[model samples]
Target: MAFGIAGTVAGSADAAEPRLMAALGNTVLTMTDIGPKHTQVSVNDKPVFEDKESDMLSFVGAYSLKDRWIALFQADTGAKDCPTRFRILEVGGPQPLVSYPFGSCSDAAQVTIDNDVLTISMPQPGGGGEAAWTYRNGKIGRTK
Candidate 1:
């Protein structure tokens, strides 16, 4: 596995855009380009998640909840039903906590943290309504 450091990737072009980063205590979380069209998430310079699909992945933000770090990412696939989706992941963890369709590719959403609650506000494509989620007991679930 090839690893890139900071602003440049090994044998890859200099990143055209800025990389997304967040600080969790002493650990650093980064979403950087592994190649021209690939993106990977690394914690303290170690690769945690790498998107191999053609869909473009963009880091939305990272937040701290109850002393745990979580990161959100947006994936754009250009599909008809759900062209765009959001991925929730625990920082330094290997898997996503949640992956849900937000809406079209151009749709916008906001993620906010209050105390220990994680709230996501966005337009529902099919007409369900707004959505909210919370992380408790080390698991992520929709607020009922």
Candidate 2:
């Protein structure tokens, strides 16, 4: 799910018509005056990760870097012997700026923003069937 904010300024007696400013989808979910029309959805069957048997699911999580970039997370599931893994997509240019993979099983993940960076934590198998993940630079770097 996503959130946005929209509002217009009132005209002053000494000035012309006021302009509109909005900060959308940063904190909480807000409705926008903009209407949705002619929206399109597309699907790709080709795999981007290494797994061939696993299926991928992508979704938008949060926005950061002054809304110039959005955090996109993709999870690859259904591997024959490996656990599920996830990847992050950076939305600024045409394609994702970074992609990271981790081990865990989850239907979806959440993103938390601090300053201009995003933090994502995942679960992994430990020595005795436990799970832990220490995410770094959009990927899981350590397991505990």
Candidate 3:
């Protein structure tokens, strides 16, 4: 009996370099790297999230003023029903501070720093549409 080696699926390999961002305290850090396996994430040189099962396209836009918050947008380039999601990660913490789901795609995101607050903006489905999010005291809230 002969066995066949499964070839790499389209868009499965990492095609971009890892972008590093400084986090709060200067000890914690965040990065987004595209590799042969898939898109990978790291915190302070430690591996965090790895998706090798499928082709993942991700973009990291901006960080909070204090560097405690990070905004990441990700999508499956190969999945038909792949939905774009915004993840707010807290450096050196378990899980993300918030995960917001959106139907529209986001090529970029921005974070606004206010007094003791962080605001995130994501593009909406229609043109010139956007969704705003606020993070404060470890809580996530939506603004119109």
Candidate structures ordered by TM-score, highest first? 1, 3, 2
CA lDDT, candidate 3, residue 99: 49
Top of the candidates by TM-score = 1
Give the Å error, residue 87, model 1.
1.4
Model 3's TM-score against the true structure: 0.53
The alpha-carbon deviation from the true structure for residue 84 of candidate 1, after best TM-score superposition, in angstroms, is 1.2
Clashing pairs in 3: 14-35
The whole-model C-alpha lDDT of candidate 3 against the native structure comes to 0.56
Predictions: Cα RMSD each: 4.9, 13.2, 8.5
What residue runs in model 3 are displaced by over 4 Å at the alpha carbon? Answer: 1-24, 28-37, 52-59, 66-84, 92-104
Q: After superposition, how far is residue 47 of candidate 1 from its true place, in Å?
A: 1.2
Q: At residue 135, give the lDDT of candidate 3.
A: 70
* lDDT winner between candidates 1 and 3: 1
TM-score of 2: 0.43
Give one digit per residue, the lDDT tens place, for model 1 in 39-102: 7877776676767653688877778776567777788775776777666666534433444434
